[model samples]
Target chain A: MASKGTVSVEVSDLRREFKGKGSPVVALDGVSLKVGQGEIFGVLGPNGAGKTTMIRILSTLLLPTGGWAKVMGFDVEHEPEKVRRVINMASGAEKAGYDFISAKKNLWFFSQLYGIPTATAEKRIMELSEMLGLTKYLDRKFYALSTGYRQRATIARAFVNEPKVVFLDEPTIGLDVMTARSIREFLKEQARRSERTIILASHNMAEVEAICDRVAIIDKGKIIAAGTPEDLMRSLGAPALVMEVSPPQSGFEMLSRVEGVKGFTASTEEERGLSTVHIVVETDAAARAAEDAVKREGLKVVASWRKQATLEEVFVALVGRGFKEREEQDVV
Target chain B: MKARALVRLWSIFGEPLWIVVSMGFPVLSSLALSLLYYSIGAASYVGFAVLGGVMVSFWGNVLWSMASQFYWDKQEGLFEIYLTSPAPISAILIGMSVGGIIGTVPSALIVTGIGWVLFHPAVNAVWGGVILTFGLTLASLYAMGMTLSSLYLAYGREAESLNEVLQEPVSMLSGLYFPSLGARSPFPLAIQAAASLIPLTIGMDALRKTLFYGNDIWQVWPDLAILGVMAVVLLFASTYALKYLENVGRRDGTIGVRIR
Candidate 1:
């Protein structure tokens, strides 16, 4: 439960397991969190981090294998209908509605599912379309709309029901920079009203940092850390260290083994023979040690500098591995 | 229900080309039976075959449009949304069935129109029996469709294959081209008993009594009773089955995972 304010969502030790080819795979392992009414909560995780799984459960689309969750004071498992009535969810990767119909028709179709009156739904659709820059494309067939517009249409559909709580899973993923920012601003504006709570699960660190009131970092089906973004970043203590090497090198696993190198990411520009290494450190001494370690590995560091702290750094500091590295690591 | 029904309506009426092509269905069904009977030197039975063709067409639409539609919706990602809404899954399905009936009626009429032109089967205008039997048959058949819809919802592509597997054999089993239950049928007792299990078979058998022989509602009350019972039981079973199978899908983590 939330420590302050009116609690809108209460989750306790929620566990979800999927049957694997040889063994069961745990998708959500003992997740618990609370979002107070009118708070914007962000869940930060890499691909396949059980963020979507949690949102799916909260929205009453999936039942938990264990534990329990309550949305708007109704148990998700026992009173799913009640939960559904109060909450709505949107996934960035989802494709919906009939492709043959216009985007407006599709929105109208979904609005009717919630039994929204036609006039009210139409007014909402118009407002959302204009807000999302989808007004011009509303008449186009869904199959004809661009991916960005289609995603915008989907977001509009999510809001047409006027849900008390909305779950957005990577809502701006794969969007253009401007569109993503606009969507962020839109969500931020919605949160500003303090009339509803928004729970968004995203892999984009900046997005979470920019819009979330509080954040939780999840990986390997577990919440590794949770707190305000500033508090979490301050927990790392040292500024992130970035090293540029003219000749890119592989085998970044060695850096993780180095003392003081909490977690480091190595991206190679092989054709350009350059690599950028972003390292999270516990102290200034660790940043210096990471620089030394890079040189000892026979990769000449052309330049080194400090960068602003981010959720990625927090994830690295907490798990001792970068998001990309941990995500690539196999989980059963 | 209205939402799904509207989508159903649009999809059915979307392409003028498909609509034009769909009109060929009843003609082909009616013509094939008439020709088959004529070829077998059993031209007198062509009336039975003509009427059989119409029922078979309705059954076919129930399979393709109503039964398999849930799988299509899941693939399109609407089923998850439906699951999350306050709207009952059964309502969506019932809506689809209602739309499917509307979409199917024109073709059914075309077949019946052909029936009058070629076979001239007796329809002594027992309007009450005819409408009641027609209505119950649709209700029971759609309820049976709702059962298949549950299977399609959870099993995905496997249950879709059942649509194809069910098409022709069901027509044969239901005796859509012949009477299966009476001594008039060539099949053995075991076959007749098996055919009786299909609601379409019962509905069509009842339809034949009323449409071909112009039997009154009193004369064919037993078949109506069976169809009514079947509708209620299947509808009840389907309602529970939809919920149970959806839960199974959720437990398996397969509900929202789309696959070919």
Candidate 2:
């Protein structure tokens, strides 16, 4: 470990390119960022946006074609062994550990790889299994455990060494809501208790918003924005307003005409004869103005509420499109 | 260290049936081949056939148990976990090789016991040279297997097919069933030259010379020296290959690829 106050992860002009059919595809393009010790940093991006690539680089699993990155003050390229000693990663890309072995046995084997003494590893495994609600499942073979339990085992494996930095790439993908919530809570508790830097790369916006202290939105292999979740939503400079109107309003032209109402999106429910409109305004007064305009238009207001912009809205506003849209475009 | 070794050992022996098949295959082949040699009026070659059978078993262990384990671990996503650990790759391979040896011992013993009982071949009586030759042969073969694994790691799914492609050809070229020495041997000049590149050939020839021919250690120094050199060269080559291929795999985003 470096000093207590030192940056845990640092990257500058980092680039990783893969050979494509015609030319090289840049997975990471001049990406640079820093994460402080004990910080829960989130990397949010669509498919093919290089979130996994960046995690791989920082965790010493991949080499950068250009520029540099350092994890825990150890250069990833030159000091890979040192970096590996202090960091661990878990990803949803694949299930790790031997299928024939018990989950506890898998954790023990990995702890051996890290040179953790057997006694200490056993103790740690018990503690983690208890904390993650995995104690009963630890004796089951990895193949026999459910997906959620297998994922929990993988997470426990990553923390076996009590690493200074942990890289989690969508650790909760495809799990049921309760399972996902449990993992998120475990991560939050770990971050708070150990003060270990956690770099979480995920597609779950709500999960990131709930647990991450800061987040970076990456698009097209570049980070478009990085800030605290609140700061990012605030940076949008517009409060979100959701309004339900009866009679299925023909259009949202009147609300759009309201002062400081930058834009509004409307969806209609034909069965319920109701139209729901989401209006973005620059201020609270603008929200009131939009409500008055809707009322003056002779549309019955069934319900209305003012709310802060969510991270998903902030991401769409900054990236100029929804995450799924970009993912589909990239696939084509 | 102890834990890794135990895990490797348990991984193979935990299922007794796999070990039974692994050991039975070679012994059965040895019995059939020795009978064929006896029926052909080459009764004295029973020792040669037995040695070939044992060596074949060793080669099979190297290919499937040792080499293919790399592919399995990669496919199972355990390789990446191994890489992230502070343990050196060499340590892991060594543990695996030791386990493979332990798991393959029954086959070796069965072949040796059957040959001794059926043929009563002349013993060297020089246990020192025999044991030394045996150890060197295992070391060289393991080194070669490690090198092969590096290629397999890079090749991914194609590695399984490649293993099949290489198995019989290597067995033939390395004289697993027939002696490569003597002028009447069927192997041609070019074939012999190519087979010599395989460490197992050198090891098997040396082991046969020292054990069956009652030769002294010094008499087989050249063969032992060649195997030692091959072991060193292949070990270094394997290390470099593993590192280079890992980088290329990472660059191609194929490190965790499990399509096959």
Candidate 3:
């Protein structure tokens, strides 16, 4: 972690409402948070949780209907051009100038927008391409690249200006696992080695937990929870311990009645013939107490262990439903 | 940067060129109409020939310009990208107009040349200079297209419906295919008035009066005057409209929403 100043991003009660066909949708309702410099801050939420809205406002692509947000002390709405100069955004929605020019030309054009000298721009492009594995396709037309390469190109374009702050909205959405992992690693390296501030909006729990210094979970266009990933999972309590009962267990009805258990249920899929059980425990003693009951009953436990609750589990426990459930919440 | 912007301009124009090639109906209709009039042997041979040539250039210019320039941008999702960048909206729109002129210039020349070859139209050299007014007319025409494009930005999801509804009515009212100046009925009068009020139509009228009838530039000052007014007013209106639309789009959480 780098020693930073007061704040890199200070979003103060920002509000954005969208006028739908029927009622006005409150895309972001009085959302507020602060991200320190040189940190990877993640915004986690289900689809349409106003993640993109927040990123847009921060990037100066959209303005808040109420309140204010400042990037590096510059107000987004009032000083959009200044904000634009200091930051760049890459999203799945980014339409590269495909069918129009080569990727290198695209990089050169954006470099001009940042007012970088030609020599420096070329050097930066070479560096970014090498780092992102885009050198092989730099001269290719944008439409010719695969989705993974295209996204890498977009990431390179976002950093061509050496922007102080980078906003990546769903940077790894729809990517293959390996590609997503590489992108996450690249983002982490960019933040750690270059000391750049990043605000990543994503629904991928593992990616957010692995890379983020702090995660803010947004639901219904509001930040429902904010903390480090470990802190959040810890706060959600010991998540449900999942285990597979092998060797064709006929029934597990007695598993629910175990002492110290808050609640328990099990269902079997006939094709797989594996019975899965979900148990809620009153305390740490409950898991141990329930395990003993299972063994005493002479049921072989194919696998048993206490694993840390993932961000996804923590989210479901908090929201009474998963993030995707609230996607239709009036936040555009 | 200038070269890159120029390339973007070319790429956007390229899609519309395909449309112009695909739609041969309009050109055929214009030539057919010319053949009908020529076969009828209607009055003043010189007048008909020159008038017919001017009309073809006017219609060909406007139709090809509209479909190839503004329509293609809306279709390709390029407008969203154009709006998101730091480039001034006016520059992008102006660039589109320049590309449009480039795309349509060939068609206009071809259509006019065909009319001349087939009809052996008598053209007055003095009146032909009126084509220079294309510069002013194009500026105002581009502004009008941009004004409509602002509406597209504001209504992101409904952009297609809005764009589709506006094209035919605007072209018809602008009198791209007929002698709007002589229209006498109230409906036709309204169309003529609208055409005369717009810079492109006015400029086209000047070219027709001059080339076909040998009228001097001074005789067509009325049309030029209208064009000058439309240019100033439309330019300001277009700029103001786009600025307002952009601000509204930002607030509604759809600033860069892809219309296509």
lDDT of 2 at A77: 85
Per TM-score, the best of the predicted structures is: 1
Per-model interface RMSD values are 1.4, 1.8, 3.5
Clashing pairs in 2: none
Q: Please give the clash total of every predicted structure, in order.
A: 0, 0, 1
Q: Please identify model 3 stretches exceeding 4 Å from their true place.
A: A1-3, A17-30, A93-101, A106-123, A230-240, A245-283, A288-302, A320-332, B1-5, B12-29, B42-84, B156-172, B183-190, B254-260
Docking class of 3: acceptable
Can you rank all candidates by DockQ, best first? 1, 2, 3
lDDT computed for candidate 3: 0.68
Best by DockQ: 1
Question: 1 or 3, which is superior by DockQ?
Answer: 1
Ranking by TM-score: 1, 2, 3
Supply candidate 1's per-residue lDDT for A296.
Answer: 81
Error of 3 at A321 (Å): 4.5
lDDT of 3 by residue, A1-332 (tens): 11246588899888988877999888899988888878899999998889988988898778888889998998999987677767877886555554556788778776766668889999999999998888999988778888888888888988888878899988887888887888888899988888789999999888899999999998878888888999888885666665556545655556567665544445566677665555555467888777777767676666766666778766765564445444533343
Ranking by lDDT: 1, 2, 3
lDDT of 2 at B6: 68
lDDT of 3 at A294: 70
lDDT of 1 by residue, A90-183 (tens): 8887887688788999999888889999999999999989988999999888889988899989888888898888999999989999888888
